[model samples]
Target: MFGRIGRTSVKHPWLTILAWVVAAFALVALAPALKSTTDQADFLPSHYESVQVGKVQERAFPEQDQPASIAVFWRDDNGPLTDGDKADVAKVTESLDKAGFNLVKKIETSPEAVSPNGKIALASVVASVKDPYDEKLLESVKELRKKAAPLLEGTSLKMGLTGSAADALDSQESSGDTDAMIMMATLVLIIVLLGVIFRSPLIALLPVLIIGVVFMVANGLIATAAEVFGLEADASVSAILIVVLFGVGTDYILFLLFRYREALREGQAPKQAMSDAVANVGETIASAAGAVIVAFLALLLSSLGMLRAMGPALAISVAVTLIAALTLVPAIFSLLGEKAFWPSKAWRKQPKHTLGKRIGDLTARRPGVVAGVSGGVLAVLAAGVLTFHPTFDAGSSLPDDLESVVAMEKLQSGFPAGQTDPTWVVLEKTSDGKLEQAEVEAFEKKLAASGFGEVSPGVIGAGGDVAQFAVLLKEKPSSDAAMELVSGKLRDAAHDAAPEGSRALVGGLTAVFADIQTAVNRDYSLVFPIAGLAIMVILGLLLRSVVAPWYLMLAVGLGFGAALGSTVWLFQGLQGKDGLLFTLPVIVYLFVVAIGTDYNILMVARLREEVRRGQNSADAVRHSITHSASTIGAAAIILAGTFGVLLLAKNSMLQQMGFAVAFGILLTAFVMALLLVPAVTKLIGPRAWWPGIKSDTARPAEPGPLLTEAPAGDRASV
Candidate 1:
């Protein structure tokens, strides 16, 4: 099937290229922009307690809305506020409220808003819409900051905005041109690496051109899918997509080019060599991509809407890159023919692989020693998994200099750390009748005495069937301590002290983070096994041997552990970070396990091919490694380099992710695929192919030398 595709592409290169161009243009012009949501509740199912609280707030306590942003006021001299300062703050609040900014519903303050120490005061900015991250709502936050500056010119008070809306605006502004920066870095890295390896400007620039088009098409399709299906893409999706397309896209292209060059040196015509290249590596590429797609699609089982949406989106991206690899890449290269290697005659003959030969010879001679050492290295790194910690603090990813982050730190000095976004404990009469006043007061007293934080007096809803008690935790809302309190003691206390006729539901930012932790834990259990099983099935089908798939997947699993463990060591141990991004494990799992599988498939397929050519087990291992090592090494470096660029980002989350994925890919290529897999297969011998192949005995018609001529300065024979 792939041979026929290669033949058609080579036969009519212009037509194939034209089709891609037209499709890309059409999609870009017609597709809608992808939309994302920042609301934590949007990512959770309605059944979760936090989500349920949002629904109840809308229906029962509509008028008692949470502040979208808080305007924190402090004395310029860092002293306690005097009467004149307090009066100026009130005037500024009133003036800003009357300014009529879009989405600004009201700005409210009172004597109680002042801190007990009189060092700080607050004005809560409530929004007309519930989504604090809404663009217009964020605009209101910006406008409020601007208006407040002039009003405070003569006063001793200084104001800075903090809270959901202001934080969102600051985060967006601080990450200025991050997407463009990643794109430029990835392109430059690819071009430089390719140029150094191939010594051909054309070869280096070819992937950029091809993948640039793939980028346009993939993004258009993702946007279109989101619009039609109403999927909630996260803000991070596009940045991730850039890496996936360039990294994986370049990988598939290199696979084809390597095989194409190999066939050419073996004396086939350029067009015929291209056809053979497609036929030889097509199954391997397809199987590899299939594994990645299946693993990504497994995210559909995730309880969080973000993972669910990300799964199909990434799956779609891999699928597109696969098509381009088999079709568009071949079409263009086939036309260029020998000129693709212009300015360098390296493609004309087989080059000596000094490092490849030594590694291959070692594995061929002592499979057990090689396997033991490689496996042992992975095991040692895997120990770091025990120290893994997860954090849900998105604010930590923002620059400390950001207004919201700075103000938040200042606010903590005068208020409870969780006062910015307090947890709400709701009590509702189950029978839709008014709750007894005594019961309401009793519930508030219980929550206050629970010792989690201060609890406000219960505010009854207009319907009288529902009431809310805000608990200001002593820790930051997204902190581990706050989450534990909300998910454990506070929840237990609320349920235990609810009025006899009422039920208690705990909901707020901390409650939301606690619920997310639950959903992620559930995802870990369900998604990992399903994805691993699915990839194993693909390997089994590709190799036609159940035995090969098992060990192959095991190696990939070990690689994942090593990658994650190394990340833990770097960030949690060496860097002294308390925890990694909560989603880091899932990100590392999918990228390392799925994409890493590609290298495994390539090596195993080559080993299988050499075996089919009637080479002995040792000979096959040596021959396969000698031929496949350069391709895998080059491709891995490019992919890893692209991900490594993320370390340059200001956001710590991006930096951690960048390092994990980059290091993981290198480990997969050098250790798992290059060393571990070949050694194990050498030890397993012909039985590894049992139930699929008859024997490892040399076939009379398939005669070949085990070792080809060594390049200059290398051993004459293996």
Candidate 2:
């Protein structure tokens, strides 16, 4: 099948190239803009308590105001706020009102809630608009910032905008930096590593150039698909897609190039070598990509809308990458011919027994010892799985230097921890009946008596049909305790305390994050099994052996467990954290299990190739490992290193994700690929390829197949 594909691509390289160009242009021109949402509530289903509460509030207290941003004010010298300072704050608010920002509702200032030290005061800016994340609101924030700057120029008071808007702006700026850093680092590392491996500038530049085209094409298509399907992607998805496309795209390119080099050394012309390279490595690349795509598509089962949206978007990206690997990469190479490796005569000679050969020999000599030792290391790390916990604190995901974080800390000292963002309860008449003032007062008294820390005076509806109360908790809103309290006792109290004709709703960050947790938990059960099953099917088809797929999947699963276990041990047991970020498990599972299969497929495919070439099972395992190890190891190291740079992000979620993925890739490459796979193949012997003639001793009628045409001396060198 792959051979036929190679022939068609090589036979009409120009046609293939032209098709890619047309597709790229059409997709880019037709694709709709990809949209992202930071609102946690946006990702949760309407059935969740938080969403339910939001619905209730929308219907009951439609006139309620939501603060779009907050302005935190303090004296520059850290002294008491004088009368002049209070007037200055008022003047700033007046100036913002005069500026006529379209989204600005009314700016409210309070001098009474100044800090005990008298160094700070607070002003809240509410938006008339419904969607706080709307770009217009961001524009309003920008205008407000500009207007407030000069209003305080001559005053001793210094003010900082510290709220959702500020946090959003900061997040956007930091994400831009992270994207630039990841791209630059990935490019430099890939070029340097590829240059070292191939020792040819053209060979090094080949992947960059080819994958660059693939990225543009893949992104354009992904955007089109996302738009057509109404998919929601995060800003981070673009950066991630770049890494995955280049990293995995480069891996497939290297796989083909390695074989192309081997074929060339066997005296095949550049054109025939290119065809043979694609034919030989094509199934492996396809299987690897199929696994990744299935895993990403599994995200559709996620209860969180964001994951569901992201799943198909990433799946589309990988699918395009796989197509390019099979088509675009080979076409470009076919055009470049022997000049692709120009300036490097090293391909004419083979290196001495490499590190991969030594490791393969070790595994072949004592499969039991290698398996036992490597498996034991992973098992020990897996012990940490018991300590793993999930954190709901979104604040922890943001940089501590953010003004919202700083002001939040300050607010906690003087006020209740949840004062800045309080949980709201709206009670409305359900039967088109008027809500009595006495009933509303009674409900507020019940809430205040429920030990909810503090309850603001109730604001009655203009028509006397509804009332809203702000409930402050003693704990930080995103804390586990807070979520638990809100999801449990507080919700129960609100329901039980409401009058017969009225309904009560609880809505806030804590409630929303708690609901998100439930959504993610549901996703785990739905996505994990489906993704695992889909990948197993791919493995089964690629290997043409049912039993092999089962064990191969088991190996990948163990790798996932071991990776999560190690993270749990480090973050929770050693560092004394309550839990990891809630989304870490899914991220780890998707990357580790999906990409782990790439290494497994490469090794298994090479093993089958060696076996087909008439080597016995044990010798085939050793030969395959020895031959494919360097390529797999180099690719894994580069991919893992690229993911490791995510730790450089200021966000904790990115930090944990970076460490988990990077470590998982290393574990997959070194422990599983290098050790477990070979040992198992040795133990299974020829039976590992049941239902296939991989174990049969049959030689081709011809002198040698194109893929195995490397000289005996060169084989020994590999």
Candidate 3:
């Protein structure tokens, strides 16, 4: 099947290239732009309490939809506000409301909102829209900020905005700016690294040029797929898509090019060598891509809608990359052949005692010791997973100097950290009719006395039967202490202290994060195992052996633990961070483990090929490592380098993700694939393919044919 694909692509290179170009342009021309949402409720199913609160708010108190944002006022002199300063707060609030801010209904300040110390006052700005995270509302907050600066010019109190709209505006700006940085860094890394590896400006630029087309096509397909399937994604997908497409695309191209160069060195005609390259490594690339696609598709089982959408979106990208790898890559390269590596005469002859050969010889000579040491190193690093702490504070992972974060910190100076974003408890009539003021006030007092903090009535709706109370916490909303307060005492008090005929529900950003924590924990138990099992199935099908897939997954599992553990050690232990991003484990498992499987598949497949071509187990290990090393090494370095570009971002999440992934790829390719997998397979002997006997007790190929080859005609194809 692979031979047929190679032959057809070789025979009709121009047509194949034209077909890809046409399809890419067609998709780009017709597909609508991809859309993403920032609404917290949108990320989870409707059943969660956080989501239910949003629905309840819309249905019950439509007027008190989320505050578009909050304006916090304090004396710029860092002292208590005089009565005149409070008057200025009211004056500025009224002026900002009248400033013609789009999407803002009206700004309101009250005596009750003033701190007891008289140093800080807050005015809640409500948006007219039900969805406060709407971009227009963020713009409204931006406009309101411009208006506030002028309004405060003669006042003693200074003002800053904090809350949903303000945070959204800041996040939009940060991510938007960082997107360009990440893309430029990625492209530069690919070009410079490829330039160094191939020593050809053309080859360095080729994958970038090709992947540019793949990016458009993949994005268009992903957008189309989302539209057709009703998949809702987050804004982060675009930047992520750029890295995945370029990184994976380059890896596939390098795999084929390395094989092509090998064929060229064996003296095959340019066109024939290209065909032979495709025929040999094509299945490996396909299987590698298949692993990634299926692993991503497994996110469909995720309870979170974000992953459900993201999983399929990324899966579509890898599928497109795979297609282009087998079809488009071969077609274009067939025409260039040896000229692809032009100006580098090294392609004409293989190098002697290459790093690959030395490593291969070491593993072949002492498989047991190599396996023991490599496996032991992975084991030692895996211990750090014991100290893993998951942080749901996505905002804290942002650059500290970002406006929203800075504003939030400034707001905290004169008020409770949670003042800008308070948790809400709602009491609703299980049936209908108005709630007695006595019962409502009684519930409020009960909540305050329970140490959940005092509550102020924010909205009374459903003819006074449904009521919402804003309860300010003492701690920052993103802190673990705050999560404990909300998920523990506040919720228990709310649920326990409801009026006779009413029920109470806690709702806020903190509650949302708490639920997200629960959702993530649930996903870890289900998603990781499911993705692992699915990948194992892919390996089993590709290798046609049950036993091999098990050990391969174990090696990849060890690699995953080591990757995550190292990140925890570096970021949490060494850097003294409170915790790493909660999503780190999931990200590491999917990209690192899944892609690691690709390297494992390539190496193991090569090992099997060497064994079948009449080499003993140890010699097959040597031969496989010697021949496939350059391909895996080049691909790993490029892929790892691409991810490393994320470190250029000031945001800690991207930095951590960059380091973990890049390190994991190198660990998988160099240590696990080269040392551990080969050593273990050599130790396992013929039974590694067992349940199915794929290798025979054939004579070993002369000690190092691949490392120090026989003549061109006599040597077998790599």
Candidate 4:
């Protein structure tokens, strides 16, 4: 099947090339702009309490003023705020209100609650719009910042905006930096690694060029898909797309290059070798990509809209990359010919048995020893899984040096921890009659007495119809204890304490994050099993052995456990973090299980190829390792290193994700792929290919003669 594909592609290389070019241009031109939402509430399912609360608030309190940004002010000289300072703050507030910036509702300056040390004051600026994530809101915040600069030019007060919109802008800027670093690192790693492995600038440059084109096309297509489907991807999707396209694309390229070099060593012409390479590696690349795509697509099962959207987008990307690998890659290589290796003559001859061969021989001779040792090392690491915890605090993921974070900490010390951003208990009239002042007062008193630290009532509906109370909890809003208290006790209290004709709804960041936890939990059960089953089916088809798929999956499972366990050890045990981020497990599971399987497939495919060529089962394991090791090892290192750049991100989530994935790739490539798999293959012997027992018959050897000195006909083939 692959041979046929290789022949056709080599014969019609221009057609293949032209097709890719045309498709790329069309996709780039026609696709809609990709859209992302920074609103955490949007990520949760409508069924979650947070989402329900949000819906209720939107419907009931349609005209409610939402603070788009807060102006945090502190005495630059570390002195107490005197009457002069208070007057200055008032003037600044009046100036902002008079300026009448777009989207600005009003700026309120209050001296009611000054910091205990008397060094700082707060001014809350509410926007007319409800959605804080609105672009107009961000623009207004920026304008406010610029306007405030000169207003306080000679004052001792230092002021900055610190609220949802400001923080979102900061996060977006940081993410852009993170993306740049990740891309630069990945590009350098791919170039250097491919250059070293192939010793050809053209070969090294080809993937960058091809995948670059793929990225532009893929992103454009994803934008169009998102627009058509009305899907909302996370802000980080672009960064992730870069990594996936390059990482997966490079893997496929290496697979083909390895087989191409092998075909060349057998004396095939450049064009024939290119065809043969595609034919041989195409199935493995496709199957590997199928597993990755299925795993990412499984994210559609996630209750969180963000994950559901990401699943399809990433799946689309890998699918495009897979198509490019089989078509565009081969077409380009066919054109390049021997010139692809021009600078490096290493392709003309085969190196003698080296380091990989010795390792393979060791495993073949003592399979049990190798298996036990490798399994034990992973087991020891897996022990750390017991300590794993999940953190829902998005603030914790940000660097502590940010002004909002610092101000938040200071606010925590001086007042109720939730005061910085209180949950709103929105009371809606269930009946047609207007809500009376008596009912509003009674509800406010009940809420205040319900163990809530602070309850501030805003103006009820005109003529005192419906009322709203901003309730502050005693604990940090995003803390687990706080979320539990709010989601369970506080919610119950609010509903029970509401007036007979009015109902209460709790809506805030903490509530949203807690609901996201519920969504993720639901997804774990659905996405994991579905994705695992899908990959198993792919493996079954590719290997033509049900039994092999089971064991292969088990190996990947162990790799997942080991990766999670190692993260737990590093972050929980050593770093003393409260817990892993809530989303880490799923991220780790997808990358480790899916990408890990890529290495496993490459090794196993080679093992099967060796067995088919008439080597004994043990000899096949050894031969596969010797023949396939360098290619797999080089690819793994580059992929792992590319992921490692995530650690450089200022955000903790990215750092954790970067390290976990990088570690998993190292484990999968070096330990699982190189050691555990070969050792286990040696133990399983012929049963590894059970039901397909061509293992019982010694098959034909390679067409080339075995000896160093070849016969005339053998020389022609070799």
- State TM-scores per candidate: 0.94, 0.91, 0.92, 0.92
Candidate 3 residue spans exceeding 4 A from truth? 130-156, 171-176, 398-403, 432-438, 499-501, 694-696, 699-718
Model 4, 1-718: lDDT tens per residue?
6667778878899998888888888888887778898777888867777777677666556776767767767777757788888888888988998999877789987877566677667788888876677778778787888898999988888777776777666655555577788889999999998888778899888899999989987898889899988999997788889888988888888877777777777888889878767766778888899999999999988888888889999999999998888878888899888899888887676666477788889988999999999888888887877788888876777877776676666556456777666887777788778787778888888888877668897557554455677877888777888888888888899889877766777778777877777778788888888899999999778776777888778788788888889989998888888878888888787667877788888777777666666778788777777766777777788888988988877777777898898998889888888889878977888788777644645788556312110001111111
Q: 515-563, model 2: which lDDT tens digit per residue?
A: 8888888788888988889988887787677777777777887888889
- Candidate 2 overall lDDT versus native: 0.78
Q: Candidate 1 on 138-236: residue-level lDDT in tens? A: 887887888888898978888999998998898777766778877888899889977887788999999999998998899899999888888989877
TM-score of 4: 0.92
Cα deviation of 428, candidate 2, in Å: 3.8
Worst 10 residues of 4 by lDDT: 709-718
- The Cα local distance difference test for each model comes to 0.85, 0.78, 0.80, 0.79
Tell me, what's the RMSD of every candidate? 3.5, 3.3, 3.7, 4.2
Q: Which ten residues in a row have the lowest lDDT in candidate 2?
A: 709-718
Cα lDDT tens digits, model 3, 1-718, are 7777888998999999999899889999999878898775689887777777777787887655457678888888879889899899998888887887778888998988877677778898888886778877888887787777877887787787877777777766765576687778778877887777678888889898899989989989999988988888787788778878877888788777777777877789988887777777777788888889888888888889888899999999999998888888888888987788889775565555366678889999999999999999888877789999888666787777765776677667666777867888888888666888788888888887887665775467767887788887888887888887898888988899997788899888888888888888898888888888988887777666888888998999899999999888899889888888888887787668877677888888777666656878888887778777766776677778777877776678778888999898888888899899999998898898776555658844434222111111112122
lDDT agreement of model 1 with the native: 0.85
Error of 3 at 681 (Å): 1.2
